[model samples]
Target: MTDPVSEFSRPNVAAGPNPFSLSALPDNVAFVALFFQRDHYCTNCRSQVQDLADRIEEFHERDTEVVSIVPESVDHVEEWQSRYDLPYPLLADPDASVGDAYDQPVRFGILGALSDFFGRMPAVVIVDRRGDEPVIAATHRGRSTFDRPDINELIAELDELRSA
Candidate 1:
């Protein structure tokens, strides 16, 4: 099977030298917190990313990279980047291929597949890169639009990973 982390690559709209890929993170980066958004207009998604941005230093301190992926075109993600001025990588997954590869939740079957707004829920995947290849160390697949982990919960997960 193809490693999704290696396969996933996208243009970084926020604070990128260029494209961001899980397989090519900086050597110092031990983990990657991949945030999958429901859509471009979800206020909860926006707020979550902003919250991550605000506490980015915590991630950095643990040698983790915080990445937020939106299943929207580059233009939309660019607007978000411009508006939020996020400190970490803000990626645009126009086709949501990466989200699909990571098994991000999609409800309502056909309708959810047709419209991210209606079906897609939030998800967070933590990739541990300490091994020879990146591995999915943890995941939080939201059952509801609001069912997602808080910043502190994420930090705790990272701490647990580091200790392990």
Candidate 2:
């Protein structure tokens, strides 16, 4: 049930003096929802991230950690976070290695191949960390740029996990 991406090092946008890494998640963390974004240019993706950002406290109350991964550099993610005022960490996947590992799409069709150079398809991967090793609990792969998980549904799922 282990996904090696959990062992990868990524730059945390909010990491301070004591830098953070995926492997360094808090012990109390019940699970981690990894939101894979195409890039800062996708408004739908931004909105999705914003929705999660707005409900960060609820996530904390449920002992779940949410993170974002973008197929761009740390600097780009930093700028995007500042623009949206996101409180959670945005992990940089400059080469899309993590995205590739999770099978996050690079494009849809021939014309979409253009995205291969600049973007990643939107996706949501929930990894339950309560077990000895992180396990994939659920996942949603966007069919289009605008596709994303429903906020309410995501919350409900997290709540269900909390009560389990």
Candidate 3:
């Protein structure tokens, strides 16, 4: 079976990198990909991002940057950041291509039959910088989820992926 992470590199990733028209991203950077949905994980993830924000020093020490990517507008980003107290950059990718690039979805099966579904980016990722292919530092989902994961454990896992 093909690995799920490898699935991201496939050619079918369409429709994202929203607010910014620029294609591609910096190669030498570590970023936690915070994908959003209209609700669900998007809203919940704000809390996670805020928690991460509260400990900005730790994230900087680990050399990881928290970037929240969403199809929402700048207004949405502003509202969420202020409401949730998130301290990181809330980037808009209205096209949602960045979410497609990450390839990990929250519910994981809502991509089909769009008429009947509302979906979310149910996971978070710490992607490695400077790699020919970005390495996934840590992903959160399935059982011991984000709000519940050991913060220290998450920090440790992220710490281990330090980019040179």
Local accuracy by lDDT, each model: 0.89, 0.76, 0.49
Top model by lDDT, which number? 1
In terms of lDDT, model 1 sits at 0.89
Candidate 2 lDDT, tens digit per residue, 11-97? 777532124455677788887888988875677777888888889888888787888887788788888878887777778788777
| Regions of model 2 farther than 4 Å from truth | 1-6, 15-20, 109-114, 117-119
Order of the predicted models by lDDT, top scorer first: 1, 2, 3
Clashes of each: 0, 0, 9
Q: Mind sharing the TM-score for model 3?
A: 0.61
Model 1, stretches more than 4 Å misplaced?
A: 1-6
Stretches of candidate 3 exceeding 4 Å from the true structure: 1-43, 106-117, 130-134, 141-150
Instruction: Please provide, for model 3 over 52-131, each residue's C-alpha lDDT reduced to its tens digit, 9 standing for 90 to 100.
Output: 66876686666565555555545665566557665555665445555656653545354531411244434466666544
What shift in Å separates residue 106 of candidate 1 from its native position after superposition? 0.4
Which should have the higher lDDT, number 1 or number 3?
A: 1
